[model samples]
Target: MNKQGTFVAVATSILAMAAAGSASAAESGKFQIKAFATKVAVDGAITKVKVDQLRLPAGADTRAKDAWVPTVAAEYFFSPRVSVETICCVTQHDVRGSGPLNGAALVDNAEVIPATVTVKYHFPLSSGVKPYVGAGPAYFMVFGEKVGASARALGATKVGLSSELGAALQAGVDIPLPGKAVGLSIDVKRYFVDTTAQFRAGDRVVLETKHKLDPWVASAGVAWRF
Candidate 1:
């Protein structure tokens, strides 16, 4: 056999053995966690109406909002093969315009809260790290008051129901902690959330805003077994 072909065969055999041998270290049953996060998105003008409709004055041609929020989640591992993860996060949008409003630039603010649940399948890697993937739904509640408006802008305070569906891909290194009773793990996750709204300002249809957020989360936390 060629040297490269022989090497590949031996490497494959080693990987299979490692996966089988590592099962003893992964016997822990249930899993849960709490983590904090900050997230943001790139605002795009998907339609001209959505763009032209944005209230801006002279000197500016485009607009964007920077948003951030804190979050927490818990997951239940039914088996080494399966688990469910749920998260609660809240985000607020800050709208900026290049114009004068009462001698300063016009700005507006709004907020939303999203809760998600997913079921995952875990796969063992050669490095003793477990990589997982999952997908499911999220429920969102959008609300808040308008900033810098003369009249109360209730466009954002209305509540709406949405079905957010996406996939989650993550990797974590599980480190042995004292007494083997606990483990320290660091995981990174990418979640996709999308939704739209029915909102109004005064007597006019302020907007039917749609939000698409794909948040990258870095979690360094502990896992306990019972």
Candidate 2:
């Protein structure tokens, strides 16, 4: 099956298991699992140039393409108003040149794992809706970076992106369904992160630059509590 199909099957199985548990037990459950359809939008502008062997244009800039993927989160409630949450997902992107080098590809098929953990505060409301905010540290793990066609044409044989540590700010809301054990969740997180890209030809380093990869992650999904 495709990735989306696999994700749906996994989520459905988990939700079914949660539902099979006693309703009374679920109402007082401290754990929650969520499956989300997420969008990752990145700002991959060059912040600084460390080395310039390729003699790029003065106004050269880059942008990473946005991606949509499946994501999962697990949360443990410390109390009715407080919780700790972590999420798992992998996203892919390509960095393309902008401005002077418009339409040129710089990095191809770069994959990232945005590992995050957050402490959240859920506010009580008169209605059944729950609004929450969170803050946490995030680690961006980049891998599978390839030198793009344009870079290869310029004598680049290899490319690498360094992983970095950063911060995340989150805000969202949850609306409970008829059964309190299941709900709909909407979430948004802004990440403050950066990375260094290195381009190499054989054993020599051809170019190196720093980039701001701050991304906005938005998600909507179903949540199960048990």
In order, candidate lDDTs are 0.50, 0.87
Clashing pairs in 1: none
Superposed on all Cα atoms, the candidates' RMSDs to the truth, in angstroms, are 9.6, 10.3
Q: RMSD of model 2, in Å?
A: 10.3
Q: Any runs in candidate 1 off by more than 4 Å, and if so which?
A: 1-29, 37-70, 97-109, 125-128, 145-180, 195-201, 206-211
Weakest ten-residue segment in model 1 by summed lDDT = 44-53
What TM-score number comes out for model 1? 0.57
The best candidate by TM-score is 2
Tens digit of per-residue lDDT, candidate 1, span 1-226: 8433543454455345435544544554576665544454534121222322335344432233555555666778656656677877767654443334223322345565656666655675665456665555555454563443422242333323234554444445555455667666666655554554333454455544454545555666665545
